[model samples]
Target: MSHHTAAKLSRSIISRLGTRGFSVNISETTQTFARLRPAFAIRNLSTSVSPNGSPKDEKNNSISSDKSQNDKIIPSYWGVAPAKLTKEDGSAWKWNCFRPWETYTADVSIHVTKHHKPENFRDKFAYWTVQALKYPTHLFFQRRHMCHAMLLETVAAVPGMVGGMLLHCKSLRRFEHSGGWIKALLEEAENERMHLMTFIDLAKPAWYERALVFAVQGVFFNAYFLAYLASPKLAHRIVGYLEEEAVISYSEFLKDLDNGSFENVPAPAIAIDYWRLPPDSTLRDVVVVIRADETHHRDLNHYASDIQCQGHELKDAPAPIGYH
Candidate 1:
């Protein structure tokens, strides 16, 4: 079959899958999203040899052996088990596992700028969650509030995805710091992607339907803004609020990570351990990094707002984009 036909077939399957959940429509869209996939192809495939004619696995082992002595081996701060430890549980063990710097390299190139959109059941739920938050009625699901927060997180990631793509596109055009920035953007995308999924995993079927409506509403809001670019002052305040919210949510997530609640969230999960090592990288360090990134993002809104309302009123304002 032609590639186009194959794609259409894949999309059709995705649509059918979407209907099983509360969000039938938005699930179809997210299922078809091009940017969400990772880059590896390990299924039903055999390992290959290296360029020098040695088996790839052998080469990898050789390299590992060479570096084993020089590589800093440290004990895992948390016990090796994946048991769910709560906040009031053993503090020392939990804190140790959270050490951000001790983490091994989190290879992210597997999905960055590649042709795969990672599929997790959570994507459909996330799309629906966004829809749910868009409506006033769904807000009535009060105790289901965590579902709403998750939707906000997934929606918030859209801009960052765009920014990441822009960075990549820019790199292609200029070939300057493109590679490094691409890596960073890809990592950010992966992290946000997992964050969205975690929320979906926690939500129920009914919540998914409410979430779908909310996602539609969010789309409408964006469309409305397109015609009426928010005033600089209004935009700044709005962006500021969003950044603050992101900071708070991520902080809570980090705290949960420390308590071992994060581990229960499941994998292909985006633990800080995915990229930054624990013990050396510590959860506190990760939190601090995330906070700094959010602050910078918030500061951009302040500048954008100033430009919109003050007519370049703040000469000292930061550049309006390239946050992170």
Candidate 2:
């Protein structure tokens, strides 16, 4: 193709990609694309890149050095895909750590090793225990606010997830491993029940504030889920977005588990592994397990989108007012 024709085609492709929320710089992405032409010639191109000493292409030269600086100040990449400003998982970690092990004093006073006054020791212990209990409660309130923020932040993603899921499902239909996708959905559905139940069992009257916050979340999430079924194309994107939310939510739970300081987390008997990290002691293992099912869910929706079959089946959205 001629240089003019190729550049025109590149711009057209960039415009289409932007509509789908792919927002890297067109010229830069196009240059990258050209470099990978040989790889795309074969099916199943890897999305990852390895560092290589390839010469700067014409597009890079055309752009000014200040372009990168300008891009950094824009608060977005070409004004398409939105950024996640607050890290909910990191917030969860902070809340969990604000209160470590709960401190309580023994009736029988033990002599202090460093600071020897028994009364002073007892007073310090009491003050710290009261403070510890309040810490988680305060943190929980902050988390509730943040959860609200996330829903607002990701509102635009609704259509994108729905569309993406449909595209993914349609693409996966040719593969024989379709049943696993259904199984993953079933598992997530079942887990929601336990999650609600656990919340009810441990939730205190004061926790109603948090519950109200979650109820609002339920409205958005349930509607999104319904839309997924009503329109699988949209549903796919909704679920994909939900999976991302789940990753953040569960990671927060894991951080709380490590600290062992939830204000009202249930006893082990009430809910097995209710507040504990997954059996394996590594963060990688926890993240992997949490992400795997979501990925499976994403894959299944992708496959579902691929399927040309149709139905108006509806599943009830999870309740908006669960104790959790």
Candidate 3:
């Protein structure tokens, strides 16, 4: 017979012998018939296939070879580790309290002197409460610009935390989302806190000032929490008026710096990084950015109050985020 016929006859004899419990290795040319037979098998213990269609063990070799050396040094637990950060010049980043992504150039073009007239009883009560709180701080700080800013930020940070906490608990209780209000309010709190941090770097608080902060924070936190629980509208309105006072205070701080009443100190490193200011920025630049941030906070709280006054839950409307 011809070579082709002879090969076919050999394959037929191997198939019969394989059925009779004889082991036979089939060549690629007979793979089609081998597939029809149940004897041809390659057990794959790995999870991946190579580009050339071979199994690759995930614990040993990758199916697709990665070219970059960067992939090799990453620890398996890198997902849970702190980020390796860099600055604009690729130097190592400092400040674990915040990240580069959170830094922003403040929009100093915001209208700072605008007022929300207290047309209703709720508004009136809110406005007067702020006035009552403002005079004491003004009297205490007097010309101490740095001290005043520290105290103002400490107090300003409280309302957002209160509101955010209450909203968070409510969301959990009802199994509902907060329409971004929780995150917005929490961000507002953190922004206010960063203001405090910047001011602390500018001037260290005296023992009395530290004591004052302790007392004021305790009282204000409890008061705001209760107010939020009772009436979110009034609570937010009160915070809105308070932020108006904050803007006015920062404006005064700016004026003092400009007039040489308060020395034009170099901007704190924290302030420079947080506000994305120039290398030559001074106390005046920091105050401008902070004042602008207060304007935004003022608007946010006022907007929240307006929504509630219009007979809607905070969740009924979308929050205006990215204020800072």
Candidate 4:
């Protein structure tokens, strides 16, 4: 008949009802149970007086509730649990970074390909610039897709941050909102950074490669900032083209992995936790997810360029908040 006993009984009943797929409206159910609490207390008093009402059952139920609570720590996009943590290593759940509305698969197939060609002097310059960088990477990293991905991610994470920062500043200066573009671009930047982090655990970059990341990031960050300032449209178009190349590179990575050219090492724990991947996931699984993210970024940046091409500000259209 105690308050503790009543609370435990209510929880047990609710848990059983949920498991059985009962269509109980939770608020209404709670109210109904609250009204019946007096009856429950009376029943409990009688039951406790009987020989069959063992304290062992009560102990077991309490333990079950504690276990359930311990197991309910759902992970957020950053691979940490949603709840405030009191200690490290307390998270009990894992979830994929993709939002509920986002499709977690690559939009483009390896069979479907596109090659950007020179439409004008500017287009020629962009196309040639990307190709110049791309071929050298292909030559340098040849069969080492992990290193290739690591380097590409370093460059890839730049545009979104720069674009986001510029858009944020413009919004503040103009006293206008950016139609969610700033948040969307920042999220994209963070996602790309996570890709780099995951690859770091998988590939364990050498000292030279670490040095290369610093140099590339430094130069590219400044270049991209200036480029975005000069023409946001062109900057977006360049990123779109870069993402297209990324898709192709990832396609090659997948092919090599599938052909047994690279060891199908078990996926890193960070990857598994971040992507909510199966415990038995491998590097191929991680690549598939990263390639999908790049495809989404490609589509988004190209869409932004199209808006600009049509003589509309990005603020005129709603940004895809969780496209991937």
- 219-270: candidate 4 lDDT, tens digit per residue: 9899889988998888888888899899899989999999999888999887
lDDT of 2 by residue, 159-268 (tens): 33434354346447754333333333444443333334433444333455556546645665566656655656445433443444444455565565567543323242
Looking at candidate 1, what is the lDDT of residue 231?
A: 38
TM-score of 1: 0.36
* TM-score of model number 4: 0.67
lDDT of each: 0.45, 0.39, 0.84, 0.77
Tens digits of lDDT, candidate 3, 288-314: 999999999999999999999999999
- Per-residue alpha-carbon lDDT of model 1 for 94-191, expressed as tens digits? 32323433333432222111111213333233334334534553454333444545655555555445444655666577655543434543444444
TM-score of each: 0.36, 0.31, 0.75, 0.67
Prediction 1 global C-alpha lDDT: 0.45
User: Top lDDT: which candidate number?
Assistant: 3
Please count the clashing residue pairs in each candidate, in the order shown.
Answer: 36, 11, 0, 0
What order do candidates take by TM-score, descending? Answer: 3, 4, 1, 2
Rate residue 220 of model 1 by lDDT: 43
By lDDT, highest first, what's the ranking? 3, 4, 1, 2
